[model samples]
Target: MATVENRQVVLERYIEGVPKVTDMAMKIGKIELKAPKGSGAFLVKNLYLSCDPYMRGRMRDFHGSYIPPFVPSQPIEGFGVGKVLDSDNPDFKPGDFISGITGWEEYSLIHNTSQLRKIQPDDAIPLSYHLGLLGMPGFTAYVGFYEICSPKKGEYVFVSAASGAVGQLVGQLAKLHGCYAVGSAGSRQKVDLLKNKLGFDEAFNYKEEADLDAALKRYFPEGIDIYFDNVGGEILDAALLNMRIHGRIAVCGMVSLHSISDPKGIHNLYCVVPKRIKMQGFLQSDYLDKFPEFLEHVTKNFKEGKIVYIEDMNDGLESGPAAFVGLFSGQNIGKQVICVARD
Candidate 1:
């Protein structure tokens, strides 16, 4: 068999307000498909890469973000699961499955083998689940809900962008915990996905609602105790006014604010002080030490058929750029995955 060279998706420029196709470029490049001897590195055949809203932040030149911006003309990387083609690293061997930060390319020479996790085959979940339900987004939802929000049974919980990757899981987790969960999305079909498929108690289409505050009030008649915020700007402002005393807010991502400069500011700052509401922003990496516990919890729910997940897939590495841009526009029905090269 002929040795395969990698095809990588590279960032062409740092985005300003919103990303465009012109900011990214995918092209072929040469890479060793096999791991070199005694290098403590492994070679992986990239199968799936997650498309996340947080990646949009990395596209811009931002200070105080979780990581530095993706340099121009460099291969973009994100969470992915891959099959080991060869391993000079003792922890992983050829044919082993793994997940972590991998390049948006056909293959990768991963030097920091310790950073990559070896996916256990004994676990009855699909390997791809490691990138979504069993991965960062899932952990984000779990930690945000349990640690950040700290809900009581029968308390009202609200999730914005609830049909998207992290939002869907947050709604389901809240339901599992006995909280009344409501979600908002951009489309009627997504609202259906939340209420019908994901088991959210109620869902509203933001596009159809003339007033976001009225919509939140209508659903959360008693005021919300916990709010898992995914879309910020106006939604956050609306949620702030509707929060109960001692309410908690977990700031996940702000997809609504990502596309615009001078985003709509919240006018209800007084509510936070009087209500004693706690609002916090968290990164998934901050909870990395708890991943094993999260995997155990989310996996059990999956096995017991207590959870439902949906994915919108785009085929091939070439489609990656457009698929990522679609996240900001709420084009994806569920979690977005770019199928770089199928195993």
Candidate 2:
């Protein structure tokens, strides 16, 4: 193994409101890309990087998040697809494709080779898909729908942020399970893509509807049996009022509450008593044991045209900051990815 030098994107400081360019910075440095002698670690050449809303939680100076905040003046890390450049581990080899936790840099020395799975490139799915459709967001959709929602055939399923990475797949999965599915998104284009392109039974632009509760009542006049919630706050409050008996609600992420001072309060909790609704918050990590089962189900659906995926990719690592900040503004149409090195 040889020493290697690489350039990386590092978080410069903790941010408030929307993050500016100064919040993160880039640096070039020298280091051994290869693991230490006899360390059994592998070095990876970074490729596609996922820019997700959840990363915002990691940027704040808080201890309540699932993960710790990024240290100042260091490279921020998250899920990324990469190819192995050097290896001292038995399970991984040079040139093997993988996707897992890595830094926003050109190269990373990933220890604990057991944590990185070798991706079969011949599967014909995009390697980038590992970050979205066939990855965390995909698993989030699967667990939330089948396990949390406990959906039944012919039931009505309502999804908020329906055109997003997780929401799109959840709606499609609900359809496959014989449920009537509808999605609400922020833009008209997303609404069209949901109903006309993604096979959602119905779709609406939440921005266009001044009254969310009124809008939900119109779409689910029969009442909602399953609510796959991605954006909480007033939306959650609205959905609570329209739930059917023994309804299920999976709280995946609360993107709406992330940037605000005081989050919207829910006032319709009384409906839960009469409906006996099951509302549970979940993290994708909680269902890692079901990864193989989820992969099989989602891959079959993808090949059969029962599921479709969308990605909004920017060209370089330098664009990572803006691409991430855009999630709050509804700028990305689908999963947001940043391409640092394609080959």
TM-score of each: 0.95, 0.95
Model 2 TM-score, 2 decimals: 0.95
Clashing pairs in 2: none
State in Å the error of residue 38, model 1.
3.6
The stretch of ten residues in a row with the least summed lDDT in candidate 2 is: 255-264
Number of clashes recorded per candidate: 0, 0
Q: lDDT per residue, candidate 2, 1-343, as tens digits?
A: 4566788889888877766667888888676767566988888898999887788777789877678888878888888999998788878888899988888988888885434577878556888999999888899899999988888999999999999989999999998999999999999999999988899999999888899899999999999999999988788888999999999999988843467622556688889899999889998788889999999999987988778899998988888878877887789999988999877
| Alpha carbon deviation, residue 64, candidate 2 (Å) | 3.9
Q: Tens digit of lDDT per residue, candidate 1, span 1-343?
A: 2377789999998888777777899888888677778788889999999888778777887767657788878889789989999888888888998988898999998997545788876556766777888878888898898888888999999999998889999999999999999999999999988889999999999999999899998999999999999977888899999999999999988643555823556688789999999999887777778888888888889899999888898899899999988887889999899887767
